[model samples]
Target chain A: MSSGLAQPRIRIPRSARAGEAIEIRTLMEHPMESGIRGANHAAVPRNMLSRMVVRMNGETIFAADLRNGTAANPYHVFFVRLQRSAEFEFVWTDEAGRSVRATARVAVS
Target chain B: MTTASRRALLLALVALPAAARADAALEAAMREAVGPAEPEEGGMALRLPALAENGAQVPLTVTVDSPMTAEQHVVSIHLFATRNPTPGVASFHLSPALARAEVQTRIRLAEDQQVVALAVLSDGRVLRATAETRVAVGGCLG
Candidate 1:
């Protein structure tokens, strides 16, 4: 359950038309160890990002509950309708309580 | 018990829990996500490669047909891997703020099996879909 190196990455268009749906993708660095790996479970224990939240200007637009089945370096792609310029925050948290956050801004003209 | 018989029994036991537990876990996940409402098939699209070269990361996309309005929209989506050590893949929660009821992510596949998805609508309806994927190499065992 070591998340010491957790890093969050996000991709979003810097600009978009008002009311247009924009794509947002996020990736976090983690082993996402399922704990079932290796011989007799002697290897890495279960460790994975359990929750992910995407908030736009303080209001959540999307969220995900991840499980051990989620692949390592968890990645997600989704769409959100932007009405104006907003600060988008993405946070990923693991079962160990370690969290990584990243922010991006989208301008709607 | 004879040695050969014991070995066969051990093998059988080893092979049973992964699938059996998966059934129970997946069933509970579905029940919890859908509540008392019975899931109605269709309206959800699950996209996965027919074959995946690497089981560690298989791309999956799920889309549900809905207006995504405040009055009516998809509430959440649940994914399950039929043959993994653990079946629950992930769940995506949606709101009207999202323009579409679609989510894309990557997951692990222990072996060649079917992937299931359930979409719970805001109005208490559950949509279900499944897709099969063949993995060249099994994951979850490092």
Candidate 2:
């Protein structure tokens, strides 16, 4: 089944103090079909993002395992302490093995 | 092996786990993820609106009292909607790099239910909190 999800959107402040905690927000567009029968009586074939991983300069900072109960267009906001200028990578993977990734750069002053 | 048989095998393997997971209750999943330790009540807090006009996008926040230093930090936070069709809302893994034990997100609450937040610390201590919210409009079915 085609997931029909657009690229994920991630927002991180461009820079932060070396020891400051910063908030990172992300959102992805997805149908999150629950595999339950619809009004037409056809199974929707559950297709939800099963996993999400965030890494900063190759080190995993956050990760999550999602389930079918998650709503469409999963949105998340979390905090991370900035220590150095690095590339932040976000990866989302669905049950079908399809994955979407986004990256942002943060400079620690 | 024939292409069709290989495809069948792959489907079987995938479906097996999915079915097994479906069979496991939400409590079982939480126990499996957090292990047998009983979570304490004070270190974590779960925030949810007392009354939700709509269940589609209810703002939720989870915060834990922790130094978040290298020696002591929260390792993960797991959210659960007690009465939703699926018990597991989301599980978040954290690192010392976060320097704080807090997360904010939007969630869908199927109905009036209690939202639970469970946090695991670096010292293997588990803490939890719960908040009840009344949803007038359904999010899952609607």
Q: DockQ for every model, please.
A: 0.66, 0.36
Stretches of model 2 off by over 4 angstroms after superposition: A1-4, A37-43, B1-24
lDDT of 2: 0.80
Span of 10 residues, lowest total lDDT, candidate 2 chain A: A36-45
lDDT of 2 by residue, B1-142 (tens): 3488457656755788643343345558678779988888897879999998888778888999998888999988888887676677888898888867888777888789888888989999999899999999977763
Lowest summed lDDT window (length 10), candidate 1 chain B: B1-10
TM-score of 2: 0.84
Which residue pairs come into collision in candidate 1? none
TM-score (0 to 1) of chain B, per candidate? 0.84, 0.81
Highest DockQ, which number? 1
Share of reference contacts found in each model: 0.88, 0.63
The lDDT values for all models are 0.85, 0.80
- Per-residue alpha-carbon lDDT of candidate 1 for residues A1-109, written as tens digits (9 for 90 to 100): 3447556778899999999999888888888876776334545656767899999999988899998678999899999998889999888887878877788999889
